[model samples]
Target chain A: MELLVASAIGVIMAAGVYLLLRARTLPVVLGLTLVTYAVNLFLFVTGRLTVDQAPVLNQGHESFADPLPQALVLTAIVISFGMTAVIVVMALKSYVESDSDHVDLDPQDDGEADS
Target chain B: MNHWIILPLLLPALVAPLIALAVRHDIVLQRIFSVSSTVILLVLGAILMGSTASDPVQSYHLGNWIAPFGIVLVLDRLSAMLLVLTAGLGLAVLLYAINGWDAEGRHFHPLFQFQLMGINGAFLTGDLFNLFVFFEVLLIASYGLMVHAGGAARMKAGVQYVTINLVGSGLFLIGVGLIYSVTGTLNMAHLATEVGRVDAADRALLEIGGLLLLLVFAVKAALVPVQFWLPGTYANAPPPVAALFAIMTKVGAYAIIRVYTLIFGDDAGASANLAGPWLLPAALVTMVIGMAGVLAARRLGEAVAFAVIGSMGTLLAAVSVFTQEAMAAALYYLLHSTIAGGALFLIVDLVNQRRTGYTDWLRAAPPFVHTGFIAALFLLGAMAMTGMPPLSGFIGKLLVLDGVRESSYAVWIWGLILGTSLLAIVGFARAGTTVFWKSAAVGGYLEPARPLAPALPFVAVGILLGASIVLTAFAGPVTVYLDTVAEQIYNPSGYIETVLPTSGHPEGVRP
Candidate 1:
């Protein structure tokens, strides 16, 4: 179970990072989404993997899955959702306004390598 | 009483969208809303500061939910101090902005109101999720305001600024997720406790989390490597917009102090905030870079922006040293930089207007604007920025260096003391020589009739400058309060008790 979840997170992270590194803005946004998924799962795993325990308290369950990480992950999901909306708007704005999603041909940043 | 914390948060969220009604009107309604909301915020912050100043902890459960279940707003000396800064600066800027930046009343009011809301939100939020929300509000409002006049220059800079901050926002989300996974509670005080139970091997994840948080703060604070985006963005922003922006960098400084002292202060053996190695070196570099940029910048606004970055670097460097006095020094310096820097920008805009929009420092400024009195204030303001005495900036620098001296890190202390003072002198001289030393040779910029000249902008400028001088007189008492604030931050046991009374041991997962 741990192996399966860990591998899943790794794959998700790999995919997101690849997209983030893309030249255009849309792919970078997508990359961020995938990264969010991995990060969420990775955070969930830190509470240590629990097979059957829901964070909710029931009559006879011996140990509860840690409620703290559960609560935090839920909050993370909400904030991430807001973040995704922001990035989408940012990309769309960049696309409409500049007609390109590439990072500004920054005068200061890329000069050393290009020269 | 905990609900009073909500006032700062609630006022902007409620008032922000409604600001559009002032669009067609003159600056009157805009002034009322911006000034009133910010002044109320300042008063509320003062009360919160007083309430928490001597106490160890105070908590307000949102909607009456207990900690570990519902979201909470925690107040300690550190949070209270930051709240005062965020609110006080918000009011001052709003005040200056009313007449100074309100030349075109159309869109400035709404955007200014929204940005203040965002800043206040960042200061007040105890939950990590809300921090991101406030950042979005601030950044989005900034984007609109940056290009409010819709010029190509402003728009171009806005694109880069928005894009980079989005990247920063993304990193922040990932960080929160990682931290939540490890600690379980979103309440900062609770997370501090939960974070300690994890074994040393798992600490790297926390370090990454710490780094990401630091990354966001560093980007905003405009520290060394991530700092390049700040100058272009700030320089092109409209005048009043630039004055408001003067306080924005300090928000990042505030967060760095809060997070370091609260979240990562203790996690000693293995699981530190990853702040140690990078911060000191980076801070030194940031200051040096600031000095270098100031020297190199041809445009007046750009020089001011670069100088602002260097002052922030000095503050951050003090923070990285992580001693009580060092923190106080950083705190004092943060306030000094915000006031002096903000005043300088307002003056820049004023002088630029007089020059009829030539912001190049080396270009001859309009002669009608620089009477001996005005020139004298400009020189004195420059001196204050450089830490010369009988002025506010000097005293603040003394406290910080004194803190450094006590730490006994002789070389770095000497480096910060001598290096910062020397670079400050160089940067100020470079910009001032171009700006004030020579009288304007113009048939170029027209002379205005003596009595018919602009009165209001200079009045606003005088108020801002006078406020800074007053701070110098009260410096002794203020430094003591700041020292106490520093102690609360470094040892946040008092902080923990205020938030979660049952949680005995102090744990530092985050601030």
Candidate 2:
């Protein structure tokens, strides 16, 4: 279970990074979404993987998954969702203003010299 | 549990919603609420600072829940001081914004208030996860403000800024998760107690987690290798928003000081001074690169932005030592740099507003009305930024240099800080001369597109510069206060006990 979760997280994060490096804003937004997903999963498993266990303490339950990470994941999900919405709107706005989808302000002058 | 500790967060949170909902369409009403709330915040902050002066660390657990189980807001001399600074800066920037900058966009007042709430929350939160939440709050508010008066350039820069910060947010969560997994606690006070007892096997994970967190703070602080986003964002952001952002980077610095000194300081058995080794070198490099950028900038606003980065480098170098004297000096430098950087941004805006054709560009232009007064303000701002005598910047640098003199890296610290000051002086001089002095040879006065008073902006600039002068004049008492602040920072027993008065371990949960 740990291997499955950890590998899934690694693969998702790698894909996120790849998408993040793309020159278009949509891909970057998608990349951020993917990264957030991976983070949520990573946070979910931080309490150690447990199946068929209550997240909170119960008299009948001898084992329980840590509930704090679950709460943390919930908050992370909400924030990431809101942020994704914000970025999408911003990207669309930038596209309309510059009339270009490429992330750089001037695609022709894309170099490290000026920045 | 002094209720005042929570007011800094509550007042802005409540006022922001009121402005957004009740007065969304009324700029006048929005400004009135925003400005009044900020004034109250400043007063509240001063009260908190005074309270902490007598009683250092005070923690307020939400819902009266015990520590480690519930979210907590820890108020200390550090948080109180930052709260006051944020409110003061917010008020000045709010005034300058209402002077006409707010009209450029809708919802400026709400967003400004929300930004203040986030900053104050970040300063006051005692839990790592809560800090992340506040960071998001601020970043979200800043995004709205960043592109508030949107142009093509500003919007594009805004997109880039949002992307980088999203990536940073991901890293932040990963760091917090790693730390939580090992320590089984996210409360900073609880983590401080737990960090030392981690198994030998888990120490590496904890260290990696700590360093990852450092990277996140470094990104926010605009430390080297992660500072690429600052110049573009600051230059493109509306001057008033950029001025408020002067406190944002300091948020990162504040977090570094808080987390490192309290959680990973000398008491942590295996991870003692976890950030010390990496911080100094990166800080020195940050100084060099920032000054070089200042020298190379083609626009006045961009130059000031780079100067901010340089100042952060200087401030962090002092903090890297972790000694009370050095931390005191770092706090003073932090206060000085925020005011100076904020003033310079405002001054650049004034210059931009006046120039006929080239707004804030470094080339000579036709003279404008009030050139002498605006130029004089710019000169004083530049002097403070470049650490010239008779201003707070000079005193800040001297304190930093003297504080770090006993360290092994003294030679490097001395050499880099001194060299960078020279670089900054030259850079500011060249920009000032081209903008103010060389413009005298140009043909005509820059006629106004509209009749302008610019009284509020000048007043705003004057208030900030006056604060800098006050910092210089009262350096003695200020340093004495900062000495206690630093002393409280290094000795976290007071903080830890206040946050978690019972068992060192959190009793309610298990991992």
Candidate 3:
């Protein structure tokens, strides 16, 4: 189970990095989303992998899983969702207005850069 | 148990939702509520500053939970000082925004309040995970504020800013995850104790985690090699928003100070000074790069943006020394640079508003209306920004130089700081003369540019510039206060004891 989770995170991060380096805005947004998924997994695993252990204490139980990382991951997921939404709208606006999804401003035209 | 420490966070957190829900469309009502909350925050911040000055360290655990278990908000001298600074900048920028700039966008008031909540929470958080959460809160609000008055340039910049910071946030999570995995705790005081007692076999992992955390802060601080996103984002942001962003970089510096001093200081077994060797060189290079950007910039706003980057470089270079005196000097510079940078941005906006064709471009265009008044303000702002004598910038540079006199790299620090100050002066002088003086020589008359930028905006800029003067005039008392703040940070035992009282042993003791 540990190996599976680690490999999944690695692969997701690899793909995210590849997409993030692209010159276009849409791919970059997608790349960021993918990377965030990997981050969430990493955060979740910080509490260690426990299949049957309860996150809450039972009077008779000797041990329970760490619950803090779970809470942290849930909060992270919600925040990332909001951030992705904002980025998507921003990318769409830029695409529609500039008619080019290229991320960098046009270097040849300084006046148009301001506009 | 002190409730005032939490007010800075709670006031903004409550008021932001209220504005969005009830006064979302009423600009007047939104202004009233936002301004009132910010004023209250300023008073609370001042009160906390005074109280913390005497006691030096206070912690408030949520819901009566014990330390190292529940969330905690720590208020020390450093956090209190930063709270006051954030409130001051927030109120000033909001006042400037109220002068018709708020009408350009929807939900401006709510977004502003949310941004404040994020900044204050970042300062007060005693847990690493909580810090990451506040960072997101601030970044999200910043995204909304960045593109507030939507234009193609703003949208493009906003896309880049959001993407870069999202990537940074991912890195932040990885960093926090690594630390939590190694230390088994996220409360900063507990982590400090754990780090000092980690097993020898785990030292390598702990070092990696520490470096990763430093990487996260470097991105936020706009340290070189990861600082490419700041210039465009700051330049394209609405002027008032850009002014408020002057405090954002300081958040990165603050994190570096808090985490490094508390968790990775001299006593952290293998992680001691993990970032120390690289910090100084990176800061120096960042300073050089930022100044070069300032020289190359074509627009006034871009120049100011680069100057901000330069100021961060200078501030961080002093802080990277990690001595109490150096930290004190860095804090003084931090306060000065925040106000000076914000003042410059506001002046640029005022100039941009009045100039018809040239806008804020640094070219000899037809003479702008109210050139004389704007020129004087611009000159004062430029002097403050470039470390000219008789302003806070000069005093800040002098203090940093004096503080770093004993370092091994004192020669390099001195040479780089002086060289960069020279470069900054030349850049500002050329830009100022071109915009204000050369234009007059070529056009010889004030063309009725746009009626004049309204008086209220000038008043806003004056208030900020006035604060810079106060910072200069009161440098002695401010330095004395920051000296105490730095002393408290360097000696983290008091902070650890306050936050984790249940751990009977002092901070460095292993359980």
In model 2, which residue pairs have backbone atoms overlapping below 3 Å?
A: none
Chain A TM per prediction: 0.82, 0.87, 0.89
Residue A48 lDDT in model 3? 82
Greater lDDT among 1 and 3 belongs to: 3
Locate the minimum summed-lDDT window of 10 residues in model 2 chain B.
B502-511
lDDT of 2 by residue, B5-49 (tens): 899889989999999999889888988999999999999999999
Q: Could you tell which candidate, 2 or 3, scores higher by TM-score?
A: 2
Compose the digit string of candidate 2's lDDT tens values, residues A1-115: 7788899999999999999999999999999999999999999889888888886888888788788898999999999999999999999999999999889867322111221
Cα lDDT tens digits for candidate 3, A54-80: 667667877778777888899999989
Q: Which residue pairs come into collision in candidate 1?
A: A43-B181, A68-B184, A69-B184, B57-B498, B263-B510
Docking class of 3: medium
Pairs of colliding residues, candidate 3: none
lDDT of 3 at A10: 99
lDDT of 1 by residue, B224-316 (tens): 889998988888787567767777898788778777767676744355545866788888888888877877777767877887888888888
**Cα-based lDDT at residue B214, candidate 2:** 98
Q: Which wins on TM-score, candidate 1 or candidate 2?
A: 2
Top of the candidates by DockQ = 3
TM-score per candidate, chains pooled = 0.86, 0.98, 0.96
